[model samples]
Target: MKKLSLLLPIAAIPVLVFADNKQMTTVTYLDRGNLQLVATEEPSSFARQITENTPNQDRRHTLENYINSLLKANAIYNHKEGKENPRLIYQIHANNEGTIIATRSEQGKYGVQIGNRSLPVYGINYDLQSDCSWQEQLCWVFYPSSNHQKERWLEISYAPHAIAELKEGVSLLIRNLQK
Candidate 1:
């Protein structure tokens, strides 16, 4: 019994880690009017764990709804209605750490804005050092300046691209809320 108890914990370690992986979900939202999109990329294993371990379907649904609501409330999904035609939006791909992998724009109006926008906008790119960095391994969000050929806004630690956009959009939306 004593030996069995010691082995049990060791055996449980992999299970615990696997359980943790299952709770991750990837979500993506697009705002055509604002030309913005937010996406969360969770490992497949993690997402499966979350779905399987959720107590009930209602709880799972609620969680998904909440995430969707957050995306829309933050203007990540083009809150404006009745617009005849909106531009394609940028995409926000996030990993488990909430770090955005990339911000890709479809070839269209959205692509043009991404290329032409003069103001500072949130973006993700790789950090290259003396050591070679693989594309998949490098991910970050920073403000890219238009005036300078090689200028970057202060780069902070990894954060979800959607959350970052939501933070900025929420303030703007609040001002318009009363109106």
Candidate 2:
């Protein structure tokens, strides 16, 4: 009976370790021949409240436009075949966590701030939940006439400094909207 009791606590060790560091996000990039489709999400309530007085569809569109502008302002670019300056569709879904999705082709030197330290993103794995893959379109489907392209995004969790930064951005956006 004593041996059984001791083993119970030992088995709980692994669960306890993983409970603190939950799998934050999985960025899926579907490559449809010429263009890439990257999808991720943000906190839905926060996104919806960004434009409080607007209609549901309009609010989502406005949020997507705002995020796309942020991407451009940060100099993040996505490429497409046969287009000099291709404008990719920024499909920002409302979900959980602040996630950044990137493929293997994206080897840009970006830095992340964790707490007081800023570290360069050198493809260093940090409990990545799943791998991203490119899939060839097998069937023709009805895509919206207005929106059909995909854009990349950024997400962060388990990092205090990064969360603080995101909060600051959200506060600034709200303040500006109030003005």
Candidate 3:
């Protein structure tokens, strides 16, 4: 009877291990910038964020909405809106230590989840006017100006091809986030 009980518990170990792996997600970390993301397996095209959020590079409402979403998310943790540092959207709780994950909805927007809240995720657009290598053009860079700022990440998928100058901007950002 003792042997059977020990064997039963051992058998359950493999099952539990496999279950945990199945629930694991794909997270990429960008070290230099100190950012991590479980990027949306299905990120919508940059054209979508531009057209859907605003018409023809209006930049007014689109920027405002994006700002509002950040403010909303930041407010949750910091308990202050607008004035507070906006990075709270992607920041994990001190207790939970959860992962930063970006998920795209059928509606084609990325809502990055941090702790218990989901904030709209946006990126800057790299215009590959001629040779567009990848489907995802919105290269979400951590340091836009290479200068330190409160709002580090921005979804600029509609402006220009400046970010395209950097090799694999998206991959670089993700890899550095881990460190």
Worst 10 residues of 3 by lDDT: 9-18
Tell me the tens digit of each residue's lDDT in model 1 across 94-115.
Answer: 3333233333332353344443
Q: Which stretch of 10 consecutive residues in model 1 shows the poorest summed lDDT?
A: 9-18
What TM value does model 3 have?
0.21
Instruction: Supply candidate 3's per-residue lDDT for 89.
Output: 31
- Return the lDDT, model 2, position 14: 16
TM-score of 1: 0.20
What C-alpha lDDT, on a 0 to 100 scale, does residue 58 get in candidate 1?
A: 41
lDDT of 2 by residue, 36-68 (tens): 333333324443356676664455346545554
Candidate 2: C-alpha RMSD after superposition: 20.4
Which portions of model 1 miss their true places by more than 4 Å? 1-85, 102-165, 168-179
Candidate 2 local accuracy as lDDT? 0.31
Candidate models: Cα lDDT each = 0.32, 0.31, 0.32
Give the Cα error of residue 133 in candidate 3, in Å. Answer: 31
Enumerate residue pairs that collide in model 1.
21-46, 22-46, 22-49, 22-50, 23-50, 31-78
Score every model by TM-score.
0.20, 0.23, 0.21
